[model samples]
Target: DFSEGLARVKVGNKWGFIKEEGGVVIPPQFDEVYDFSEGLAVVKIGNKYRYIDKEGGFVFNIEFEWAQSFSGGQARVKFGDKYFEINKEGKIITQGREDLFPVKIGDKYGYIDISFNIRIEPQFDEACDFREDLAAVKIKDKWGYINKEGEIKIKPRFAGCLSFSEGLAAVSEFDKKWGYINKDGKYEIQPKFDMAMDFSGDRAEVKIGLTRYYINRNGEIIKEIIDIEHEEI
Candidate 1:
């Protein structure tokens, strides 16, 4: 990600990579270009997949049906109907495409890393992407969480869910209400509200009864969006 400075963006569009300060360095010549991540980005040219360095140099030959932005040294790509990850050399980084999705081998869902590696086993009723080294996994029709090692960090309880952010995750109870959960799956903000969302910039939008408000990370009321005592119009 261009966290600082500007240049001709590493990728291309009509104007290619736009630097942070708004300088065109690489000169976007790519039919499609993505933001730089880990010093590299995915680029496309004439129906080919490849990677490009910050200087706009092609790092590898385009050899995939489709490609996406690189993340953690790899990117999710497709080849002839199957998706996989490829290194900068345009080589399949894994044994095959088995790890590119949450495959339900028999009757469960889980995650797989780029190497066809079972980062999380297929043992959950459902699963979501990993965030903060953790992911939401369902068990017995209830929601929970698991670590990268496939260990259950938080037991299934929520009725609905979302990925973690700013240290909390949205959760819902089967009989109670929806709220946010800490890393331990315990309701940091109890399941008392009618609905809630994860924390964003130290504050989260929350709903109680029929009112919506913003709350700090500590679950303390920060501002009420509709105080009802205020005038509208």
Candidate 2:
């Protein structure tokens, strides 16, 4: 898939990058490569992973056992069963968000402030990070939305759900079919897709049976994805 104006392509058994105009930008060499993020991409050579620039130049001399694409100016990497967030200069980030952090006491989960004070008492069966002022929490076996003050904004009814992106969140009901919902606990897009992803920009990716495509906020299919290698030459 194309990301940040470049797409990784496979030639024979090696992976490389190409421009949108179908011109080879980075020759096929790496064993595996991830989509670029924040002007850098993770490339795997042999069993080690490293970051590389658009010109195929190595950004970091140190290699990691596993690495992920950069997001919000940082990327997570694993060395020996431990994951660490690193910056573009390969420096480990120790500080996290100052707002609220998920904390687990016994078997229940809750949120705590940066000063280690319990902001929300641990009561949820499961809790996730807050996004757009709302967090997804599990009560017994159902999922619901909760505000930062621990108020139940949306009742626990969904079988599964994701944090809100843009202005909506993807959720599943008893039928296990995924759909979208607004902040008021109203369905914006009816449940029908076999799987649904959070909206990125103005489009969200969805799957129905064996077909996967992009859908707009209005539940309209905007583009159909076709594998590059599968296209007729």
Candidate 3:
């Protein structure tokens, strides 16, 4: 089920879309189906995948061996042997051998292009997926941010750090307390929370003492959820 007024259902060997009342809307004709995003969903037929609108109509003629949902109007799709970004209109935004995602080599992590080209040398002990155009990477027990060009955007400093959310990321220092930092690596919210979470809709859920509360990006508590149960991740 998704916010687009449709739910996924499997009937026998195929999958399709249904309504809240279990009424078949698209029928079980697809080999597989992914959740709707924006206004389209990825459906698999035969061996190729294509994007379909709410009425189960193809949005464009473009098809791929594999495809992912659209985000920010761009979707990642795998062609014959390379990955590329396609817009809603089915125009390739970035093609060629650029992987645009991180790759693991031996025991190190680095970025690679679609053709498996080592754009960024494998050197980090640990790395995470890119968020807000920057990725959190660990080198020598310190975490920092890196740009797509493999250059250090923020020097490795924090004991631990998370991917950016709402233009800020949660970081921890030697004290093991969580705070928020901007893209420039400046502390926008000082370390205070015993536990922190990523910001969503301008608000973040945090824990202090034994209670959970929601805080704005300014680090001000907006509301508290009493008697809630949670465990540290």
Candidate 4:
């Protein structure tokens, strides 16, 4: 149930939150804001950012170079170009490796535990969020997915990818496009997009030139692209 009536809201000049029915609960005043999680939300004010509570309060008065929303009781926050995990109470309790985050590392990435300990060290060089205890990690440029135990569950072959959603993940292989795959690493849909995005309601977004279109699981174009610069291809 929505305690404040609004699940999301815009506060002032920037987007913040108030709860149900636009109550100005958090005071709309940030460059960007994420939905409330575990009673807290991440907000960016000016160039600096911090987390705020439902009561428009700060949870521990801490800030970081970058941050991920609280997950499994903690969130990954960055400092001085390095990533680490902090508890909900705003305490720095875990530290990530130099290249754990990956996209900026090389071609692989790893995960850390609550104690700032490396659970999965700097590996895949490229990786997406862990889903179903598995994360899509990249190696040498090809993205395969691995489990929390650092075991390669699905071998990397797709060029670009995203984490699993509804037991399927989107993967891309050549300059022409994107497709979907199952948890077992088998193609649910062939790689064939000029551009592609994740699936929502059994429909995924694909692009033709600069226009966007939606396709169903059977690979049928259910929707057409609109307002796109057709020449941008």
Best-fitting candidate, measured by lDDT?
2
Instruction: Give per-model TM-scores.
Output: 0.55, 0.58, 0.56, 0.54
What are the per-residue Cα lDDT tens digits for candidate 4 across 106-160?
3335665433345676765656656656687778868888877788988878778
In order, what is each prediction's RMSD in angstroms? 12.0, 15.6, 12.2, 13.3
Winner on TM-score between 1 and 3 is 3
Which runs of model 4 end up more than 4 angstroms from their true locations?
Answer: 1-85, 88-108, 228-233
Kindly report which residue stretches of model 1 are placed more than 4 angstroms away from their true locations once superposed. Answer: 1-103, 226-233
Each model's C-alpha lDDT?
0.70, 0.87, 0.83, 0.69
Give one digit per residue, the lDDT tens place, for model 1 in 126-190.
Answer: 77767777778788878888777788898877788888998899888788787788797777777
Model 2 vs. true fold: TM: 0.58
Clashing residue pairs for model 3:
97-114, 98-114, 99-113, 99-114
Q: Model 1 Cα displacement at 86 (Å)?
A: 4.8
Of 3 and 4, which scores higher on lDDT? 3
lDDT of 3 by residue, 67-170 (tens): 99998999988764456677888766643422356656667888764443567888898887678889999999999999988899999988978889899899
TM-score of 1: 0.55
